[model samples]
Target: MTKQTGGKRWGRKATGESAQVRDGRPRRSRRNTFREDEDLEEQINFSDIKRIGVYLKPYLKQGAVILAAVLSMSAIAVAIPYLTKTMIDTVIPSKDPVKLFTLGGVFLVAIVVYELLLRYRTVAITRVGQLMLKDMRRDLFTHIQTLPFSYFDSRPHGKILIRVVNYVNTLSDTLSSGLINVIADIFTFLLTLIVMFLIDWRLTLWSLVLMPLLVVYVLFLQHFQRRAYQRLSNKQSNLNAYIHESIAGVKTTQTFVREREQFQTFQEQQGQVRKYWMKAVHIQYLMWPGVQNISTITIALIYYLGITGMGGVQVTTGMLIAFVGYANNFWNPIINIGNFYNQLITCSAYLERIFETLDVRPEIEDKPGAVELPPIKGRVDFNDVVFKYEPDGRNILNLVDFHVPAGSTVALVGPTGAGKTTIVNLLSRFYDVSEGSVCVDGYDVRDVTLSSLRRQMGVMLQDTFIFTGNVRENIRYGRLDATDEEIVEAAKAVHAHEFIMELPQGYDTKVEERGSTLSAGQRQLIAFSRVLLADPRILILDEATSSIDTRTEEALQAGLAHLLKGRTSFVIAHRLSTIEHSDQIFYIDHGQIIEHGTHEELLAKKGAYYRLHESQYAMIKTANGEEG
Candidate 1:
């Protein structure tokens, strides 16, 4: 393992090969090893700790209270040992009833005060910790939003979720109580040491003879403890990623009767988590016995040597008794400190992962001095555009040059993987071109703020995602401030109003997550309605009408044509009718436009486009007995 350096950052280029099959399923690996980064670094630097300190800065007043409580609690704990000595040597031996009662009352009052301070400390620190967590999680989620698509593309949903939820919660455990306990233990240890020395310095020195050995043993165990926790953390992330994938694709699993297989995979992941946890536990458990044995030996030495009055220096019974109490306090605090150190080691791994994500700069961020895109006229130009998903990979689009006049309809027709979607992705600036520029209204896309550029463009993809919400709420997602009337009008435009009204709760009907409660066609219509409500100047419809029935599609096409009349639109479709009315068509092949013209003009050319149209849709036309 590498020692952590002060400076290391998450590189922008998402680095990973596709671990998926042609069917879009992740390839399963039989290898039992988790992400065992042998060169994984240890030690979060002071700068990262200071970043955390910034979170605590806002709760300084609460921290002051907690500090006061901790000091009070520690003082009371030390006082109890001294009070026991006083009672045994003074009040009880004096044979005065009044004095004994006074000492007992004082002890009871001290206990009450200690309890109150402990309670206050718990409440205040817990409140402060919760507030810090809220701030941290918010910052993380907000930062995630600003990240480019490639980050999400390379990482698993479950892994991200774990960082936001479980890992943050783990940090909360350390911040809220673990840290305070460490501080209290330190104070208790020091106070006990001072009092023990004042009582009998010789005995105190003798009792701590085994201290260096204990320290050495704990320090050795720490390295193993850290390695075990790293493995455990990696296993948990893997398990969560698998579970998330499984749950997200449960319908596919059930339909294909792969539940048993998936269950077996889950069991394997679970067993790995348990095995790693046990290894960590094995290391942690060693501390308890090691500390116990050393502590026992220390006390035995103190008692045996003190009975002989160390070098003719006499020792009183009360003083010896007090020394023993202080000895227990001294050794036990070491054990507590060891436990705290172990927790810090475990938490450090999680902290590193979280910060690594935060350090990744967005690959497609606007350049310095980028401006807000003006109201665009929607004239897009691709000037010798070249792109590849990977840095050194084959170009997906090679020297592509095109100009789309404002407010024109262009149909993209191609085979799968023929760069149909890649063109649109570049146009939207979802990714930057590798070797050339994509310009919107003469302004290079990279020179404009992403929000201003994307806000004016609407894309409806083949796979429509519907967030869990009521029908009205889902429609309003496109324009957050859109009125209910405007939402209804948008739905009506897409011919979704009729079906939506027929539902039990109409517009108020609650949709399940991913719109599972809605039919495919219904979800597509809702997605169309959302885009319509947004009323973007540039519209992209990729297989938009594929899911609707013939009659419903006809109705939707009318609304779509009305919506598309004055906007620059790009359409990708397989159906002949969907592109039949397009103003121009670009027939692409092998990342180049082989043919481009209107439908009739392309037919007259009798080239690639003509053959493609005839072979692809001619059979369907013949089956319907329609003129080809």
Candidate 2:
């Protein structure tokens, strides 16, 4: 073995005749051991490897102990063949019983010591490998979390998950399996070769004639199996997409009585997997037969040459036994090297995905030297802001400017498709403006850290999202450290305490997945309580009561009014009753504010807001005699 280093990087590349096959074999046809160094060097961006090396610094001492154990264990493994040689060549043949018994005793003792060192080395390597895997996973997860929303929007979650699950796992696998196989195989192979040559060079040379065939077979496995594995990964990701979409819309399927259709769709997808699995299996099937043929050929050569004594040499029985035992050694390493090669190539695409996410620069982040937003006064402003969802989509907001004064309530009313929601999205910094800027309390929203800016605002959307947890934990999600008393108080303030207390375990009851156990009205009350616990100085109520029954809406309206007082509030309302009492109203259409005034002023003008409010559809009632 030799090390090749340049730019302080390590690679093992055998050169010239060392890479050649044995005599009497066509060496030029055999595959070379080393990869194309320049190709790998250019492709594998191991920039963070230096960081990984730093992590290994603390483990060097333990690593040294493990290395010593590995070397000693290897020496003991090599000792077994030599001891048999000694018994056959000397003690037993000399008819010296005492010498035979002493050799037997020493062999027993060596086996005991070897087992201890082997166990210790296994534990040490595993412990170090696990620690490194843990640190690597943490860093990868953190990097992924910081990536921009657009990154996730463009990429599938299953593809990203494959990176987190399978790709990162490969970081340690190189050390655990690929590396261990190479070292153990080379050491055992080398020691056996030296011993076989010493016993009879002619026989050793003949035995090695089959190596070229073995090397050729392994290279084919590496190439074909690698391609198969990639297809397998792609097929698996497709299956994940189907499963995610199916589960997400299970209700729609059931409502339409489409269970059979859904099952048929899944079966079609599973059928694809079966086809790919067969291709992968067939490629794998070809490898073992190739290997078995090489082994069989080597044994045939041995018998033919040995029986004829054509080389003018008498190969002893012990030598033949040792050579047969040595031949079995090739089986496992040959298979493992092929398997590792397959895994390595499959993970390459996954690693690219993970690294791409990690390398993304967030669209919004705290600027250099950004300072804390101290004691906000609840003032909000958007100046000459122009924005659109896509570059080709109609401008969601044109050159619009708006302001909400401290200690005031402002309502934004418009027909459907008006940019009412966009206004609130800008205020929350869910997105930044395409032109101009939004400022909160004299600080640019982008200049302030996201966490700092978000801490000062409370948002209640039309679609209330509740995670799977008990009522207490869900309310406390707003402020994780809130005391139980504070959580209960917030719930009571929102009129949610009555409904929560009636559940199976009061605040401790587990809300089913996505809070399916709760009604839309019940969930919204809990969501409002969640916002109340955060105690933001600026609040957004964007159709906050849209999904509730009239009675529940009425019960919470007073508390909502109280919550709105003394805070810069922006309310996006479709229902005229919700926003009629605001200090100011902005009637937005086609991404522009066509009118702005008090509700009475807008009503007097008989503009867009007035038209929407006057429509009979706005007050349609159901058979239950409730407002639509």
Candidate closest to the true structure, highest lDDT = 1
Q: What would the TM-scores of all predictions be?
A: 0.91, 0.82
Candidate 1 lDDT by residue in tens digits, 208-274: 7898998899888878887787778788888888888899999999999999999999998889999
What tens digits encode model 2's per-residue C-alpha lDDT throughout 400-483?
787778867888877788788878877777777776678987788878878888898999998899999889999999899999
List runs of model 2 lying over 4 Å from the truth. 1-67, 114-144, 151-176, 191-205, 299-315, 330-335, 349-361, 390-394, 616-628
Candidate 2 has an lDDT of 0.70
lDDT per model vs. reference: 0.81, 0.70
